[model samples]
Target: MESMNIPMRDILQRILKRRKIRPRPGLNYNLEKQEEPGVSIDLDATLASMDTMEFSLVRENSTRRHHNEGSEDEVSTMADSLTSHQYKSYIVSMVHRLRANTDVQLGVSGEKVEVDPVGSKGTKFFKQRAMTYDADNIASCEVLEEKSTGKSVFRITYLISHDYKHSDFEADSEVCNEIVSKINNILELRLSPARKDYVATRAAKHLRKRDSLRDSFRLSKYTDN
Candidate 1:
């Protein structure tokens, strides 16, 4: 019913739950709760529960695709603005040439994203698809980084999901593993020191220029009792 970007989604859910906002007469939000995400992932449920908190930290060490449409979750043109992942996907699709390391990342909604050539990629907005109003579901994703001896050797991640009504973290672990595998194959085949600077630098720019990982509380409607 309510939505908006905020600090860590999980933390927000806990706050809402304790404050007696959840299962009550209201829009929606999240709190500071924890659970085992297991090995599986559900991109759809993850995205649908944008205002809720995380079920597990181990499973949630990933990225999301969202942005404020004037600080409100409901919008006439939800797709006009791009979430971070949506932006990432759009840019990749725009200038992507498969000859490069760019691989299309698909999630539960059957939506796709890609990475740009290891270069200075800007965090800009493009367009988005109309978000379906399914209070019971969401699509979520993560960017995976594999390290070797203190250096990232491989990196890849994507969103996963299941039916909106099903929020079970372990429900789609198998599908999540498969998504990870697809990304890893692409990264292992394309990642290299020569292009490392380009790829790493861009992501670093995003890290430095983007919002904090724990700032979801102040932003989402779920926490805005």
Candidate 2:
């Protein structure tokens, strides 16, 4: 029986060989043909183009950053300049108001005189005069007069230029108070003892109003900006 099975297997093998059946190829022919030299060159070119695009993007981003930084710095500088100008204008305006309220006299001749509010060196001349009262230079003294007799009683000099060095708002308040104190002292000394209490009560009101007006102006400016 085993000998009969071996002859049948030999017959089957010969029949299959005559029919010419073959095994499949290991590599895919279509894929191999598609990946030719031209395709590889195109892939390399695509990679190079991507690198160039990436470099361009990086450079553009860096340029934009630098431009933004420069613009920010310019804006900051402009804002600082505007603030400084506004502060100076406020100081000059205050000096003008002081001159308007009080009688101004030249220190040299002890004669009553009028000073120009617009062209006068506002704080600079005041500071100089406070440091050293010059005979030749224009050093003016402010005179506070009694309303009843129209008589010059209290003489308070302006030393506002000394406050230019103090940048803080509190320092400005202190300087204003110091000036007020000088005025009040002169009033107390010149007036009768009976009116001393009344004079002291009204001492801070005028200066306080001036400071309030200044603060309001600053607040409005900040809001507008």
Sum up the clashes in candidate 2: 0
Instruction: Quote the positional error of residue 146 for candidate 2 in Å.
Output: 27
Segments of candidate 1 deviating more than 4 angstroms: 1-171, 192-195, 198-225
Candidate 1, 202: how far from true, in Å? 8.8
| Global Cα lDDT for candidate 1 | 0.31
Whose TM-score is greatest here? Answer: 1
Taking the tens digit of each residue's C-alpha lDDT, what string does model 2 give over 1-225? 112222323322322333243324652111001113111112212222322211111111122233356555644432232122111111211223234232222111111112223343445335212222221122222333333432223333322333211111111333334333332333322233323433444477777988999999999999999
Question: For all candidates, what are the clash counts?
Answer: 41, 0
> Candidate 2 — worst ten consecutive residues by lDDT sum?
52-61
TM-score of each: 0.18, 0.17
